[model samples]
Target: MTTILVTGGTGTLGRLVTERLREGGHEVRVLSRKAEPYAVDLREGGPALDRAVEGVEAVVHCASTPRGGDERAARNLIGAARRAGVPHLVYISIVGVDRVPLGYYKAKHAVERLVEGSGLGWTVLRATQFHELVQQMLSTFARSPVMVLPAGVADQPIEVAEVADRLAGLAVRPPAGRVPDMGGPEVRTFPDLARAYLRATGRRRAVVSVPLAGKTYRAFRSGGHLAPEQAVGKGTFEEYLRR
Candidate 1:
């Protein structure tokens, strides 16, 4: 059994990754701001950060914040991993980070570069958006009688559990430089997805599409964030809503 450290181990995806690693008989350390034994904020890496990565065979970086600070967290983690001589560092990133113009995606792309050049054997898997995120978006819109969605935008929402499974498997394997992109079983437009959510939840709401103006929105409309060729995810959004 190997010792692995999973950053953001308590978050949606990270929590599952941590569980999977532990179930495989590996000693897993969960690093989060509030997690016990390793409650270190990665954004403010210090001695505690060093201790977290110490003696671990690999680190699966799943901790990220949409509000910001992702780049700083990644840098701190990379430094800690390097100091501890961690042999492998695996990172989860979005499929369109390099192509999209969103600030979050830019930070993700920057982190990807850091991981690539960290001098440690590394693996990076870029996946499409998760179902939970999509659900959250829809839920927010559902609060109102009218739902506004981006026009001409399609998303391939993958199952977060499946991603966790893949990350767990990668944590133990030899570092493979950027693996194939992972996507969902089908690509559905935003309006369609929103309608499906309404149907599943029995909520009556008028779904409206608005063409957002910006390079970021344009990139999304152009399907720069999609991975149709890599639609390997098993679960469908409708199936997810049913559950």
Candidate 2:
């Protein structure tokens, strides 16, 4: 079994990937700030990274920061992987990162460029927004009797589990350089999603569609964040709510 190093193994997607790797009988080393099997911080460059990555065959780079720090974090991790002579580097990025002009997306796009130009065997999987994120959005907007949603657009969201599975599969295989984009099974509008969520939760509420103005709003309206043709996830909003 090959030894694989997983950065951000404590996170949602990272934890899932680590579990899958371990289940497949591979030696899985997790890099986190807190004490664990292997602990390393990307921001703090030192021997810690060298120790964490020692003897590892591949690196699954799932660690990332907020919009501002994402690019820097990616660069640091790439450098470390090169130094460790890791054969493959798998990066998880969001769909529409290039089409959208958001700060976080800008950082993601920058990181993709770094990985592509690193001359390393690398694969980037661009996935749609997670189901959990949609749930959170619903919960946040549905605080009052009226759930306010952006009137202009919709999204095709995927489950974290599906994305995690894809990431794990990519980690085990050789790099394929920018895999196909993955998305949810259904195309849903924000208000429709909110309504469904309220129904599933047995909460009585009215979803109010509010037209928003700005580049962010226009991006959403233009379907910048979805991949309807590439919806590969089997989970739907109803199924997610049931779970």
Range of the 10 consecutive residues with the lowest summed lDDT in candidate 2: 66-75
Cα-based lDDT at residue 116, candidate 1: 98
Task: Judging by TM-score against the true structure, name the best candidate.
Answer: 1
Residue range 1-243, candidate 2, lDDT tens digits: 989988889998899999989988999888987746567667775778878876788888888876366676667777878888888989899899998888888888898999999878999999998888899888988789788888868988788888988888898899899999999999888878887899899998877888988897899789998999899998888788899
Candidate number achieving the greatest lDDT relative to the actual structure: 1
Instruction: Give residue 106's error in model 2 in angstroms.
Output: 0.8
In order of appearance, the predictions have TM-scores of 0.98, 0.96
RMSD of each: 0.8, 1.3
Candidate 1 structure quality by residue, lDDT tens digits, 1-243: 999999999999999999999999999999999998999998899999999999999999999988999989999999989889999999999999999999999999999999999999999999999999999999998999899998899999999999999999999999999999999999999989998999999999999998889899999999999999999999999889988
Query: Where does candidate 1 stray beyond 4 Å?
Result: none
After TM-score superposition, the amount by which residue 173's alpha carbon in candidate 2 deviates from its true location, in angstroms, is 1.2
